[model samples]
Target: MTVLVTGANGLIGRALCERLQQKKQAFRAAVRPGVPVQPGCDVAEVGELNQATNWCRALTGVDIVIHLAARVHVMHDKSADPLAVFRTVNVDGTLNLARQAVDAGVKRFVFVSSIKVNGEATKMGRPFTEADAPNPQDAYGQSKCEAEQGLRQIAMDTGIEVVIIRPPLVYGPGVKANFAALMRAVQRGWPLPLGAVHNQRSLVALDNLVDFIITCMTHLQAANQTFLVSDGQDLSTTELVRGMAQAAGVSARLLPVPVWVLQAGAKLLGKGDAVQRLCGNLQVDISKARDLLGWVPPVSVEEGLGRCVRG
Candidate 1:
């Protein structure tokens, strides 16, 4: 089976392609025009993804298409219409591609969506499940949720299998953004005022997510299903930082600041969203993936963190 992977140079895309290569899977890496092709892979230069982007060249002879490319969440978006900007790519582009894939005889399309589709945060011990109603809080999340809805409609009409995988914070080598900043801070021995915060967050290692994606590529049980994926272990902010420090072989200097004080200070500094991310509960229950696919994360969180820091 020839698999076509979009966003082949991204963090998750890169890892997924590497794993596919190691297994000798027949695959094509679809990258935007001018983006250098990954070495030792069949590549198709599909230009910017949008409602009108032509994907015929990329979809030829492809049995499965893993759609990973999208307009990712931005911290300080300057767009006048954030939702419209996101839909142009995340929703419109996604549905456009799925329609063309169906025409191209692609049997399955696996979309890598975000946990933000569930909501920003979950109450303690009441982790999000696949059956819960969507409560997207941002444009990015809304776009993904809309795309999923459209894909479901297309699946019903076209008989093309659609597998949606919603993963929480995914981290591994080459990770950037907040995870990277946290790693740098820990390595630099910067004292963090999150020692007293107690909140559980779910994260999926790149390897584990890639594994699940590959499984869904052909697993019969995965067709037309949505699954929430994680490392099967939840960590508090304190535990996460300590784990990072341990992985980096450094000492973590975490202050025992009260959660309310931190929240109030964040509000005063216009960093409430950022602080909520640091001190919030956003766990996802992966029992469905476990019970249905019998898939376990091949890499432990400690090992994944070690690879991330040591890389």
Candidate 2:
């Protein structure tokens, strides 16, 4: 099947392209201007994603589309209206692509959504599932949620199939942001005040996420379905730091700071969001993907972490 992968230079997109090449699947990579595409793969240069953008050239002879291009949330965004910026790309741009895909005779569209669609955090021991109503907290999450709704409506209006996969924090080789920072700190033998933070969060390795995305490409049961994906392993803040330390060949020096104390200090320092992320309970129940699509994460968390550190 001929497939088109947007955002081909991104973390998950690049990994997915490599895997698809390994499997000898025919596909085309769509990358933004100045972003390098995977060598030996068919490529098209698609510029900024917005409502006015035309995808006719990129959609040529493609049967499936994996839309990953979006205006991701900035931690300290200076934009006056973050939601409007997000909606322009994540919602309107996505819908525009979906309509063009339908016109182009595309059979399926796989969307890589965020776990924030379910909510920012979950109660201890109560993981978020696909059945739960969406409760997006931030503009980014709200945009994704709106995109999902728009895609579903388009799917209903047109006969094209739409599959949504919401993954929590994705980490692996080439991962940046918090995960990379944590790994660097661990490798440097820095002491972290997370021993008393017992909150659990789920993460999906790049390999696992790519595997699931490919599975959804042709799985008959995945049509018009929304699936929550993870590595099937949950880790607390302390455990995660220790695991990273193990991979980095260092001892995890953790300070036993009380969670309440940490929260209060973070609030005073205007770092409450950072504190919540570090000590947040964000778990996902991925039974639907397992039972329905017959998919499981092939890589263990330990193995994935090792690759992340080594890379």
Models 1 onward score TM values of 0.99, 0.99
Candidate 2 regions exceeding 4 Å error are none
> What digit string (tens of lDDT, one per residue) describes model 1 on residues 1-311?
89999999899999999999999999999998788756999999987789999999999999999999999999999999999999999999999999999999999999999999999999999999999999999999999999999999999999999999999999999999999999999999999998998999999988899999999999999999999999999999999999999999999999999999999999999999999999999999999999999988999999999989987
Candidate 1 structure, TM-score to reference: 0.99
TM-score of 2: 0.99
lDDT of 2: 0.93
